[model samples]
Target: MPGWALALPIALLTLIPVAAVIGAALSPQPEVWDHLIRHVLPRVTANTALLMLLVGLGVLCVGVPLAWLTALCVFPGQRFFAWALMLPLAFPAYVLAFVQMGLFEFAGPVQSRLRDWFGSSAWFPEIRGSLWGTVLVLTMAFYPYVYLLTRNAFVTQGRRALEAARMLGESAPRAFWRVSVPMARPWIVGGLALAWMETLADFGAVAVFNYDTFTTALYKAWFDLHNLGAAAQLAALLVLLVLVMAAAEQRSQRGRSYQVASSHCQPIVLRGWHRWVAFGACALVFAASFAIPIVQLVLWSLSTWREELEPRYWDFARNTVLLAVGTAFIATTLSLVLAGVRRRHADRITAWVVRLAVIGYAVPGVVLAVGVFIPIAWLDNLLIAWLRPLGFEGFQILKGSVATMLLALSARFLAVAYHASDSAMQRITRSQEETARTLGLGSWGLLRRLYLPLLRGGLLTAFLMVMVDVMKEMPITLMTRSFGWDTLAVRVFQLTTESMWENAAVPALAIVAVGLLPVVLIFQRAERIQGA
Candidate 1:
C-alpha cells in the first residue's frame, strides 16, 4: 500500500466527529431548539460577543506593549521577563480563574484583610462572577499567545523598519505606530484571532466565573439537559465560529511575508526613569499573571496538603498521569505515521489528509466529547444487538470506556504531536534517505536505523506536549470520562464549582508543574529562533 493511504483512517476519524455534530444539528430537534433559542441562544451569543471584544482588547493592551518593551528596549530583566511572561501559559486559564477568585473574592484573604483594616464599608470592587473578573482572568492567562508571536516578530525583524521611519524624520512614537506595528500586523492579528478562538472555546474558565458562552451552553445541553441533539447543535454552532476565526487567521497570514530577520539593528537603550518604567511594567504583569498566583497556589496547597493529599488525590493524580501518558503515546505514534506519510509522498492527498487529521486541535474538547461519544455509543449499541443472540444480554463496549476517552483526546492533541514530529522529520535530508535506499534498506530499516535517532527528541517533545495538554484538559474528560476516572483537571473543576478553591490548589499545582516543561521548551525554541 502507498504511504499516503495510512493517513486515510486518521483523517476519517477527525471528519466523523465533525460530521456527526453537523448532521445532528441539521436534524429536526424542535424541543431542543425551542429551549435553546428562547433561553440559551440569545444570552450565549451576547455573552460570547462581549467576551470576545473585551478579551481581544484586553490581550492586545496587555500583551503587545509588553512584547514591544521586552523586544525593542534594553530594560532591567528584559531577558528574564521575555520568558517569565509566558509562565502564565503553564497554568490553564481555569486554574488561573479560580486562583484569582481565591485571592480576590469577598471572603478571601485580600478582601478579608482589607475589610479588617479599612472597615466593612471600604469600597472594594467585586471581581468574582463579574465581567471585570472574567476578562482579567482570561487576559492574564491568554496574553502569552499574543506576546510570544509579536515578540518573536520584533526580535527577528528588530528596528530595521523603525530605523527607516526614523530616517524619514518620523517621531519615534509615530515611527513605531506606522512601521513596527504594521510590519507585525499579521503576527499581531493572527495572535489576536488565536486568543479569541481560545476564548470562545473555553469552558472551564467561563464556567468557573459563571460566565455564559457557547462552550458552557454546549456543556449544559449535553450534561445538564441530557439532550444529545441540543449538544450536537451547539457544537455545530461552535464549529462554525471556529471556522470563521480560522478563516480570518488564514487571511492574515496570506499576504507578502513581513518577517525579516536582521541582527544589525540593535535594541533602543532606555535612560534612568524610562528604564525603571520598562522594568516596572514587565515586573507588574509578570507578578500579577504568574508569580503571584503561583505563590498563592503553593501556599494554599501547603496549607491543605495534609487532608487534600489523601488516597483519592493520588487517584486523581494517577488518572491524570495515565490519561496524559496514554494519549501522548497514541498521539505521538499516529502523528509520526502521518508525518512520515506526508514526508515520503509529498502529495496533495496525503497533505490534505494530514491537515484534516490535525485540525481536531482547534475543535473544542467538549465538541469532540459529544461527537466522539455519539458514534461510539451507536457502535456499542450495535454490538449489543449482535451479541444478544448469543446470550450476551448486557455487554457494552467503547461507550464511556478509557478507549473512547483516549480516542477523543488523541484527536484533540494529534496536531501537537504531528507538528513536533514533522518538524524533526524535516531536519532529515533527502540525501540521507537516498543513501539508505542505495544501501538496499527497506522503509522499516530506514525508519529504524536513520529516523529513530533523529526523531527521539521530537517524539519526546510531542509526548510531553500532549501529556501536559491532556493533564490540563477539562471539558472532554468531564463529559466523556468513565466512572471513577476523575483527573486532576476534573478535581479542580469540582472544587471550583463548589467554590472550594483552596482544596483545588494541590492538583492545580501538580498540573502546572507538568505544564511548565512545555513553557520552558517554548522559551528555548524562541531563543533558537532569535539566534537563527
Candidate 2:
C-alpha cells in the first residue's frame, strides 16, 4: 500500500484541532472580539510575553550552569547530582505551585508562624498570586528540558576543545563563555524552545497561582464567560504563537552544525572551595526544585490521607488510569503505524505527512480541548436533530462520553509517541528488512515477526511516557471530560482553584509518583549515553 493511504488520514486527524480553531476564528464574533480587544487583549498579551521572557531567562540561568557543572566538572557527589538535578521532572508545575503556595500563603505554615513570632510579620514576601513565585515554580518544573539537551551537547564536546582554549592562555571561565557555550548554542536554543512551548501550553500551574496568561485567558473565556467562540479565537492566537516560535527555532538551527569528535569527555577537576561551591549550587537547585516540594507534598498527604483516601478518591484514580491507559494504547499503536509508513515509503510526501501528524505535541491542551469539542458538539447536535423523531431525546451521545477527552489527549501527545517510535525505527537497518523479505516474509509478516520483537522496548517506552503525560494532564481533562469523570489532575485543579492546597496533595502525590516512571527511563538512557 502507498504511504499516503495511512499518512494522509493521520495528518488530517492531527489537523482537525488546528482547523477548528482557525475556522472558529474566521467567523466574526463582533461583540466577543470587541470585548477582548478593548479589555482583555492588552493585559493578556503583556502578561503572556512577560511570563515567557522571565521563564526563558530563568531556565537558562537554572539549567545551563547546572548542566555544565554536571557534565564537565568533577565535584563531590558528581555522579549522583548528574541524575538528581533532573528529579524535578517528576513533579508537575501545578503540584509544585500548590505546594509552594501552601507553605507561604497567609494561613500556611511559613507566614502564619512568622506572624505569630513577630506579631506583625510585614517583611515576608508574599507568594500567592505573585508573578515571581509563579516564575520560580515554572522554571524549576521546566529546567530539565534545557539541562537534558545542553548536558548532552557538553558531553559530546571532548576535553580537547577546552584544552586548546587553555593552551591559548584563556582563563577557564572566559574559555567556557567563549568556546564551550557557543559550541552548544543549537542545543541550548532547542532546549529553550521546548521550555517556551511548555510554558505557553501551561494552565494548571498558572491557574493555581491565579496568574493571568493566554491559557488562563482562553479558559476563562470558555468557561467563565460561557463563550466557546471567544475561547476558540484566543486558542487560535496561541496556536499561531506556538507555530511562530517553532518556526523560529527551526530556522535558527537550519544551517547550523555543532557536531564534535567522538572522543570521551574528561571532566575538569575542581580544586578547594570551587569543588564545594559547585556541589552547593547543584544541591541547592535540586533541593529547592525537587526535595522541598516532595517533602511538602508528603507532609500534606499525610495530614489529609485519612479524609482524602475514601472511595471517591479511588474513582479519581480509576478515571486517571482509564484515560491514561486508553490514550497510551491509542497513541502507541498509531505511532507504530506512522513510523512503519515513514520507513517503508521514504517519500517526501510521507515524511511531511508524518511530521504534520506529530505537531500536535506543541499544541496546548486547552486549545486542543476547545478545537476538538467544536466538531463533536456539531456532530452531536446533528445526531440529536436526526434522532429526536425516533424518541432519542434529552441526550448528546458524543458530547456526553469519554470519547472527546480521549481524542483531545491523544492529539495532544501523539507527537511524543511518534518521536519515540521514529527513533526506534531508525535503529532497524535496511539490511534486516531485506533479509526478512528474502526469507519470503511480506510486509505484514515482517512487521509481525521482525519489527515487533525488535521495537518492543521502544514501543513500551512510548506507552509508559504517553501514559504518564496523560495522567498529569489537566486542561484537556478539565475541559473535555463528561460529567463525573474527574481524574486526579482534574481534582487537583479543582481543589487548588479553591485554595485547598492540603486537600489537593493526595492526588498531586499520586501524579508525581506516576510521573517518575518516565523519569527513570530518562535517567537510565542518560546513564547509557554517559557510559558510551
- Compare the candidates by lDDT and give the number of the best one: 2
Cα lDDT tens digits for candidate 2, 86-158: 8889998899899989888888888889888889767887776788999999999999999999998899988
- What C-alpha lDDT values do all the predictions have? 0.89, 0.90
lDDT of 1: 0.89
Q: Candidate 2 — what's its lDDT?
A: 0.90
Error of 2 at 157 (Å): 0.5
- Those runs of model 1 whose alpha carbons end farther than 4 Å from true positions after fitting are 2-4, 390-395
Best by TM-score: 2
TM-score of each: 0.97, 0.98
Reference-based lDDT, residue 532, model 2: 89
